[model samples]
Target: MPIQTRLFVRFALGYLLLGLVAGVVMAVDPAWRFLWPTYLHVIVVGWLTQLIFGVAFWLFPRASRDRKRGREGFIWATLVLLNVGLVLRILAEPFDLGRAAGPLLMASALCHLGAAVGFTANIWPRMGSGR
Candidate 1:
Protein backbone atom coordinates (compact mmCIF):
# COMPACT_ATOMS: atom_id res chain seq x y z
CA MET A 1 0.00 0.00 0.00
CA PRO A 2 0.95 3.71 0.05
CA ILE A 3 3.18 5.23 2.69
CA GLN A 4 0.24 6.80 4.44
CA THR A 5 -1.70 3.58 4.47
CA ARG A 6 1.32 1.70 5.70
CA LEU A 7 1.94 4.16 8.47
CA PHE A 8 -1.70 4.06 9.48
CA VAL A 9 -2.08 0.33 9.68
CA ARG A 10 1.47 -0.23 10.80
CA PHE A 11 1.15 2.11 13.75
CA ALA A 12 -2.19 0.66 14.73
CA LEU A 13 -0.79 -2.84 14.72
CA GLY A 14 2.27 -1.65 16.52
CA TYR A 15 0.08 -0.01 19.14
CA LEU A 16 -1.76 -3.28 19.57
CA LEU A 17 1.52 -5.05 20.06
CA LEU A 18 2.73 -2.44 22.46
CA GLY A 19 -0.50 -2.73 24.43
CA LEU A 20 -0.15 -6.47 24.64
CA VAL A 21 3.43 -6.24 25.73
CA ALA A 22 2.61 -3.61 28.28
CA GLY A 23 -0.25 -5.66 29.62
CA VAL A 24 1.97 -8.66 29.98
CA VAL A 25 4.64 -6.65 31.72
CA MET A 26 2.13 -5.13 34.09
CA ALA A 27 0.62 -8.48 34.86
CA VAL A 28 3.91 -10.20 35.53
CA ASP A 29 5.65 -7.31 37.28
CA PRO A 30 3.59 -5.07 39.46
CA ALA A 31 6.46 -2.80 40.33
CA TRP A 32 6.20 -0.66 37.25
CA ARG A 33 3.32 1.73 37.57
CA PHE A 34 4.88 3.93 34.97
CA LEU A 35 4.89 0.97 32.67
CA TRP A 36 1.11 0.93 32.36
CA PRO A 37 0.77 4.65 31.86
CA THR A 38 3.69 4.81 29.54
CA TYR A 39 2.44 1.84 27.62
CA LEU A 40 -1.03 3.31 27.18
CA HIS A 41 0.37 6.64 26.09
CA VAL A 42 2.73 5.01 23.69
CA ILE A 43 -0.10 3.00 22.20
CA VAL A 44 -2.74 5.68 22.32
CA VAL A 45 -0.75 8.78 21.51
CA GLY A 46 2.22 7.35 19.70
CA TRP A 47 0.89 4.47 17.69
CA LEU A 48 -2.84 5.03 17.52
CA THR A 49 -2.68 8.79 17.00
CA GLN A 50 -0.15 8.59 14.20
CA LEU A 51 -1.94 5.66 12.66
CA ILE A 52 -5.21 7.56 12.48
CA PHE A 53 -3.59 10.78 11.30
CA GLY A 54 -1.49 9.14 8.64
CA VAL A 55 -4.43 7.15 7.31
CA ALA A 56 -6.63 10.21 7.21
CA PHE A 57 -4.04 12.19 5.35
CA TRP A 58 -3.45 9.31 3.02
CA LEU A 59 -7.10 8.67 2.24
CA PHE A 60 -8.13 12.29 2.27
CA PRO A 61 -9.08 13.76 -1.09
CA ARG A 62 -6.98 16.11 -3.12
CA ALA A 63 -7.66 18.13 -6.22
CA SER A 64 -4.59 16.71 -7.95
CA ARG A 65 -1.25 15.10 -7.23
CA ASP A 66 0.35 18.52 -7.12
CA ARG A 67 -2.26 19.64 -4.62
CA LYS A 68 -1.82 16.50 -2.63
CA ARG A 69 -0.42 17.44 0.76
CA GLY A 70 0.15 13.85 1.78
CA ARG A 71 3.73 13.97 0.74
CA GLU A 72 6.43 11.59 1.92
CA GLY A 73 8.35 14.18 3.85
CA PHE A 74 5.33 15.09 5.95
CA ILE A 75 4.60 11.47 6.76
CA TRP A 76 8.15 10.60 7.76
CA ALA A 77 8.60 13.73 9.79
CA THR A 78 5.42 13.08 11.69
CA LEU A 79 6.31 9.45 12.32
CA VAL A 80 9.83 10.29 13.41
CA LEU A 81 8.75 12.91 15.89
CA LEU A 82 6.00 10.75 17.31
CA ASN A 83 8.27 7.76 17.82
CA VAL A 84 10.97 9.87 19.35
CA GLY A 85 8.56 11.36 21.86
CA LEU A 86 7.04 8.02 22.69
CA VAL A 87 10.35 6.30 23.13
CA LEU A 88 11.65 8.96 25.41
CA ARG A 89 8.47 9.00 27.41
CA ILE A 90 8.44 5.25 27.85
CA LEU A 91 12.13 4.84 28.52
CA ALA A 92 12.39 7.39 31.27
CA GLU A 93 11.31 7.01 34.87
CA PRO A 94 8.72 9.32 36.32
CA PHE A 95 11.09 10.95 38.80
CA ASP A 96 14.32 10.45 36.93
CA LEU A 97 15.21 11.76 33.46
CA GLY A 98 13.58 14.93 34.64
CA ARG A 99 16.77 16.87 34.38
CA ALA A 100 17.34 16.26 30.70
CA ALA A 101 14.87 13.95 29.03
CA GLY A 102 11.91 15.96 30.20
CA PRO A 103 12.64 18.80 27.83
CA LEU A 104 13.31 16.42 24.98
CA LEU A 105 10.05 14.68 25.69
CA MET A 106 8.27 17.99 25.62
CA ALA A 107 9.94 18.86 22.35
CA SER A 108 8.91 15.53 20.91
CA ALA A 109 5.32 16.11 21.94
CA LEU A 110 5.40 19.53 20.29
CA CYS A 111 6.75 18.05 17.13
CA HIS A 112 3.95 15.49 16.99
CA LEU A 113 1.42 18.19 17.75
CA GLY A 114 2.71 20.40 14.96
CA ALA A 115 2.72 17.50 12.56
CA ALA A 116 -0.84 16.60 13.50
CA VAL A 117 -1.97 20.16 12.94
CA GLY A 118 -0.16 20.31 9.65
CA PHE A 119 -1.63 17.01 8.56
CA THR A 120 -5.11 18.23 9.39
CA ALA A 121 -4.65 21.56 7.63
CA ASN A 122 -3.13 19.94 4.59
CA ILE A 123 -5.98 17.48 4.16
CA TRP A 124 -9.01 19.19 5.66
CA PRO A 125 -9.38 21.70 2.81
CA ARG A 126 -9.02 18.91 0.31
CA MET A 127 -11.84 16.97 1.91
CA GLY A 128 -15.08 18.44 0.61
CA SER A 129 -17.19 15.42 1.33
CA GLY A 130 -18.96 17.08 4.21
CA ARG A 131 -17.05 19.55 6.33
Candidate 2:
Protein backbone atom coordinates (compact mmCIF):
# COMPACT_ATOMS: atom_id res chain seq x y z
CA MET A 1 0.00 0.00 0.00
CA PRO A 2 1.11 3.54 -0.63
CA ILE A 3 2.41 5.62 2.25
CA GLN A 4 -0.49 8.04 1.76
CA THR A 5 -2.93 5.18 2.09
CA ARG A 6 -1.21 3.99 5.22
CA LEU A 7 -1.28 7.46 6.74
CA PHE A 8 -4.97 7.87 6.02
CA VAL A 9 -5.87 4.45 7.36
CA ARG A 10 -3.83 4.99 10.49
CA PHE A 11 -5.48 8.33 11.08
CA ALA A 12 -8.84 6.71 10.51
CA LEU A 13 -8.15 4.16 13.19
CA GLY A 14 -6.99 6.87 15.56
CA TYR A 15 -10.16 8.82 14.89
CA LEU A 16 -12.21 5.73 15.51
CA LEU A 17 -10.60 5.41 18.93
CA LEU A 18 -11.11 9.08 19.61
CA GLY A 19 -14.74 8.87 18.60
CA LEU A 20 -15.31 5.86 20.79
CA VAL A 21 -13.79 7.64 23.75
CA ALA A 22 -15.87 10.71 23.08
CA GLY A 23 -19.01 8.61 22.85
CA VAL A 24 -18.26 6.93 26.13
CA VAL A 25 -17.65 10.23 27.80
CA MET A 26 -20.94 11.55 26.57
CA ALA A 27 -22.69 8.41 27.65
CA VAL A 28 -21.25 8.65 31.14
CA ASP A 29 -22.03 12.35 31.39
CA PRO A 30 -24.96 13.65 29.44
CA ALA A 31 -23.61 17.15 29.99
CA TRP A 32 -20.96 16.39 27.41
CA ARG A 33 -23.62 15.82 24.80
CA PHE A 34 -22.65 19.04 23.13
CA LEU A 35 -19.92 17.05 21.50
CA TRP A 36 -22.46 14.85 19.77
CA PRO A 37 -21.87 16.46 16.39
CA THR A 38 -18.14 16.34 16.82
CA TYR A 39 -18.33 12.66 17.70
CA LEU A 40 -20.39 11.91 14.64
CA HIS A 41 -18.04 13.73 12.29
CA VAL A 42 -15.03 12.08 13.86
CA ILE A 43 -16.54 8.65 13.29
CA VAL A 44 -18.11 9.32 9.94
CA VAL A 45 -15.75 11.68 8.16
CA GLY A 46 -12.55 10.98 10.05
CA TRP A 47 -12.88 7.22 10.32
CA LEU A 48 -15.33 5.95 7.74
CA THR A 49 -14.66 8.39 4.93
CA GLN A 50 -10.93 8.38 5.37
CA LEU A 51 -10.87 4.60 5.48
CA ILE A 52 -12.87 4.43 2.29
CA PHE A 53 -10.62 6.94 0.59
CA GLY A 54 -7.50 5.11 1.63
CA VAL A 55 -8.81 1.78 0.44
CA ALA A 56 -10.06 3.24 -2.78
CA PHE A 57 -6.77 4.90 -3.44
CA TRP A 58 -5.06 1.58 -3.05
CA LEU A 59 -7.60 -0.42 -5.01
CA PHE A 60 -8.55 1.96 -7.75
CA PRO A 61 -7.33 1.43 -11.29
CA ARG A 62 -4.09 3.04 -12.30
CA ALA A 63 -4.25 6.11 -14.48
CA SER A 64 -1.17 4.97 -16.40
CA ARG A 65 1.91 2.76 -16.13
CA ASP A 66 4.00 5.75 -15.16
CA ARG A 67 1.51 7.32 -12.78
CA LYS A 68 -0.53 5.10 -10.55
CA ARG A 69 -3.00 6.14 -7.83
CA GLY A 70 -3.75 9.31 -9.73
CA ARG A 71 -2.10 12.38 -8.22
CA GLU A 72 0.06 12.09 -5.13
CA GLY A 73 -0.17 15.79 -4.32
CA PHE A 74 -3.96 15.70 -4.40
CA ILE A 75 -4.02 12.68 -2.14
CA TRP A 76 -1.76 14.44 0.32
CA ALA A 77 -3.90 17.56 0.14
CA THR A 78 -7.01 15.54 0.77
CA LEU A 79 -5.51 13.90 3.81
CA VAL A 80 -4.26 17.14 5.23
CA LEU A 81 -7.46 19.06 4.60
CA LEU A 82 -9.70 16.37 5.99
CA ASN A 83 -7.74 16.09 9.20
CA VAL A 84 -7.39 19.83 9.59
CA GLY A 85 -11.10 20.28 9.14
CA LEU A 86 -11.97 17.56 11.61
CA VAL A 87 -9.53 18.88 14.19
CA LEU A 88 -10.73 22.42 13.74
CA ARG A 89 -14.32 21.40 14.03
CA ILE A 90 -13.65 19.38 17.16
CA LEU A 91 -11.82 22.24 18.82
CA ALA A 92 -14.14 25.05 17.76
CA GLU A 93 -17.56 23.42 18.00
CA PRO A 94 -17.60 23.18 21.79
CA PHE A 95 -16.53 26.76 22.26
CA ASP A 96 -19.32 29.35 22.53
CA LEU A 97 -21.37 27.39 20.03
CA GLY A 98 -19.52 29.22 17.22
CA ARG A 99 -20.37 32.72 18.41
CA ALA A 100 -16.67 33.32 18.84
CA ALA A 101 -15.46 30.41 16.74
CA GLY A 102 -17.72 31.03 13.77
CA PRO A 103 -14.89 31.72 11.38
CA LEU A 104 -13.09 28.64 12.50
CA LEU A 105 -16.16 26.54 11.81
CA MET A 106 -16.48 28.09 8.37
CA ALA A 107 -12.83 27.46 7.69
CA SER A 108 -13.26 23.88 8.80
CA ALA A 109 -16.17 23.44 6.45
CA LEU A 110 -14.12 24.88 3.59
CA CYS A 111 -11.28 22.55 4.39
CA HIS A 112 -13.58 19.56 4.29
CA LEU A 113 -15.02 20.77 1.02
CA GLY A 114 -11.54 21.15 -0.39
CA ALA A 115 -10.64 17.66 0.73
CA ALA A 116 -13.69 16.22 -0.93
CA VAL A 117 -12.96 18.03 -4.16
CA GLY A 118 -9.33 17.03 -4.11
CA PHE A 119 -10.13 13.40 -3.53
CA THR A 120 -12.71 13.39 -6.28
CA ALA A 121 -10.48 15.12 -8.77
CA ASN A 122 -7.63 12.75 -8.05
CA ILE A 123 -9.72 9.61 -8.16
CA TRP A 124 -12.02 10.46 -11.03
CA PRO A 125 -9.40 9.94 -13.70
CA ARG A 126 -8.40 6.58 -12.31
CA MET A 127 -11.93 5.29 -12.01
CA GLY A 128 -12.57 2.67 -14.72
CA SER A 129 -9.36 3.70 -16.51
CA GLY A 130 -7.20 0.69 -17.30
CA ARG A 131 -3.75 0.36 -15.82
Candidate 3:
Protein backbone atom coordinates (compact mmCIF):
# COMPACT_ATOMS: atom_id res chain seq x y z
CA MET A 1 0.00 0.00 0.00
CA PRO A 2 1.03 3.61 -0.48
CA ILE A 3 2.44 5.52 2.47
CA GLN A 4 -0.62 7.71 2.68
CA THR A 5 -2.86 4.66 2.75
CA ARG A 6 -0.84 3.12 5.51
CA LEU A 7 -0.95 6.29 7.54
CA PHE A 8 -4.69 6.55 7.18
CA VAL A 9 -5.17 2.94 8.19
CA ARG A 10 -3.08 3.48 11.24
CA PHE A 11 -5.16 6.47 12.16
CA ALA A 12 -8.29 4.43 11.78
CA LEU A 13 -6.98 1.69 14.01
CA GLY A 14 -5.96 4.23 16.62
CA TYR A 15 -9.41 5.75 16.56
CA LEU A 16 -10.95 2.34 16.89
CA LEU A 17 -8.96 1.73 20.00
CA LEU A 18 -9.99 5.07 21.39
CA GLY A 19 -13.61 4.39 20.63
CA LEU A 20 -13.44 1.11 22.44
CA VAL A 21 -11.90 2.77 25.45
CA ALA A 22 -14.60 5.39 25.42
CA GLY A 23 -17.22 2.70 25.21
CA VAL A 24 -15.79 0.93 28.19
CA VAL A 25 -15.74 4.14 30.15
CA MET A 26 -19.34 4.83 29.34
CA ALA A 27 -20.31 1.33 30.28
CA VAL A 28 -18.51 1.59 33.56
CA ASP A 29 -20.03 4.87 34.61
CA PRO A 30 -23.29 6.48 33.73
CA ALA A 31 -21.92 9.92 34.49
CA TRP A 32 -19.77 9.65 31.39
CA ARG A 33 -22.79 9.26 29.14
CA PHE A 34 -22.15 12.64 27.68
CA LEU A 35 -19.20 11.13 25.80
CA TRP A 36 -21.43 8.90 23.75
CA PRO A 37 -21.49 11.27 20.82
CA THR A 38 -17.75 11.63 20.92
CA TYR A 39 -17.26 7.88 20.89
CA LEU A 40 -19.71 7.47 18.03
CA HIS A 41 -18.03 10.12 15.93
CA VAL A 42 -14.61 8.71 16.64
CA ILE A 43 -15.71 5.31 15.43
CA VAL A 44 -17.71 6.49 12.45
CA VAL A 45 -15.74 9.41 11.12
CA GLY A 46 -12.30 8.73 12.50
CA TRP A 47 -12.22 4.97 12.07
CA LEU A 48 -14.70 3.94 9.39
CA THR A 49 -14.59 6.99 7.14
CA GLN A 50 -10.83 7.21 7.33
CA LEU A 51 -10.49 3.54 6.54
CA ILE A 52 -12.77 4.01 3.56
CA PHE A 53 -10.80 6.98 2.35
CA GLY A 54 -7.53 5.12 2.63
CA VAL A 55 -8.80 2.04 0.86
CA ALA A 56 -10.50 4.07 -1.82
CA PHE A 57 -7.40 6.09 -2.46
CA TRP A 58 -5.38 2.92 -2.82
CA LEU A 59 -7.85 0.97 -4.92
CA PHE A 60 -9.22 3.67 -7.22
CA PRO A 61 -8.12 3.95 -10.81
CA ARG A 62 -5.06 5.98 -11.55
CA ALA A 63 -5.16 9.67 -12.34
CA SER A 64 -4.42 11.14 -15.75
CA ARG A 65 -0.84 11.26 -16.91
CA ASP A 66 -0.45 14.87 -15.92
CA ARG A 67 -1.50 14.31 -12.31
CA LYS A 68 -0.35 11.85 -9.67
CA ARG A 69 -3.28 10.28 -7.83
CA GLY A 70 -5.15 13.52 -8.54
CA ARG A 71 -3.31 16.14 -6.57
CA GLU A 72 -1.40 14.64 -3.67
CA GLY A 73 -1.32 17.96 -1.86
CA PHE A 74 -5.07 18.04 -1.63
CA ILE A 75 -5.14 14.53 -0.23
CA TRP A 76 -2.68 15.57 2.41
CA ALA A 77 -4.79 18.59 3.20
CA THR A 78 -7.84 16.40 3.51
CA LEU A 79 -6.10 14.13 5.94
CA VAL A 80 -4.99 17.07 8.06
CA LEU A 81 -8.35 18.77 8.02
CA LEU A 82 -10.25 15.63 8.91
CA ASN A 83 -8.03 14.89 11.88
CA VAL A 84 -8.02 18.47 13.06
CA GLY A 85 -11.75 18.67 12.93
CA LEU A 86 -12.19 15.40 14.82
CA VAL A 87 -9.70 16.45 17.44
CA LEU A 88 -11.40 19.79 17.89
CA ARG A 89 -14.76 18.17 18.27
CA ILE A 90 -13.45 15.61 20.74
CA LEU A 91 -11.84 18.25 22.92
CA ALA A 92 -14.48 20.92 22.75
CA GLU A 93 -17.68 18.93 22.90
CA PRO A 94 -17.15 17.42 26.32
CA PHE A 95 -15.90 20.62 27.89
CA ASP A 96 -18.52 22.69 26.20
CA LEU A 97 -19.62 23.84 29.66
CA GLY A 98 -22.97 24.59 28.06
CA ARG A 99 -22.92 27.18 25.27
CA ALA A 100 -19.40 28.44 25.50
CA ALA A 101 -18.16 25.95 22.95
CA GLY A 102 -20.38 27.14 20.12
CA PRO A 103 -17.54 28.71 18.16
CA LEU A 104 -15.31 25.72 18.59
CA LEU A 105 -17.99 23.30 17.46
CA MET A 106 -18.70 25.44 14.41
CA ALA A 107 -15.03 25.58 13.56
CA SER A 108 -14.75 21.82 13.95
CA ALA A 109 -17.75 21.21 11.71
CA LEU A 110 -16.37 23.56 9.06
CA CYS A 111 -13.03 21.82 9.09
CA HIS A 112 -14.69 18.46 8.63
CA LEU A 113 -16.78 19.83 5.76
CA GLY A 114 -13.67 21.22 4.14
CA ALA A 115 -12.03 17.81 4.41
CA ALA A 116 -14.99 16.16 2.72
CA VAL A 117 -14.76 18.65 -0.15
CA GLY A 118 -11.04 18.14 -0.49
CA PHE A 119 -11.37 14.38 -0.54
CA THR A 120 -14.17 14.49 -3.09
CA ALA A 121 -12.21 16.81 -5.35
CA ASN A 122 -9.11 14.68 -5.09
CA ILE A 123 -10.91 11.46 -5.96
CA TRP A 124 -13.56 12.53 -8.48
CA PRO A 125 -11.35 12.55 -11.55
CA ARG A 126 -9.84 9.21 -10.75
CA MET A 127 -13.23 7.65 -11.49
CA GLY A 128 -12.15 7.82 -15.14
CA SER A 129 -14.15 8.54 -18.28
CA GLY A 130 -15.86 5.17 -18.72
CA ARG A 131 -12.64 3.78 -20.00
What is the lDDT of every predicted structure here? 0.69, 0.93, 0.89
Candidate achieving the largest lDDT: 2
True lDDT of residue 95, candidate 2: 64
Model 1 lDDT tens row, 1-131: 57666766776687778778878888888886567677778778866677777677666676467766544566666666666766666666344765787686677668668667656556666766675
Q: Clashing residue pairs, candidate 1?
A: none
Clashes of each: 0, 0, 0
In angstroms, give how far residue 66 of model 1 lies from its true place.
Answer: 3.5
* Colliding pairs, model 3: none
Best-matching candidate per TM-score: 2
- What is the alpha-carbon lDDT of model 1 when measured against the actual structure? 0.69
- Report the C-alpha displacement of residue 53, candidate 1, in angstroms: 1.7
lDDT score, residue 92, model 2? 93
lDDT of 3 by residue, 22-87 (tens): 999999998999999889999999999999988988888889767758888778888888899999
Worst 10 residues of 1 by lDDT: 89-98
For candidate 1, what is the TM-score? 0.77
What candidate 1 gets wrong by more than 4 Å, as runs, is 69-72, 93-95, 129-131
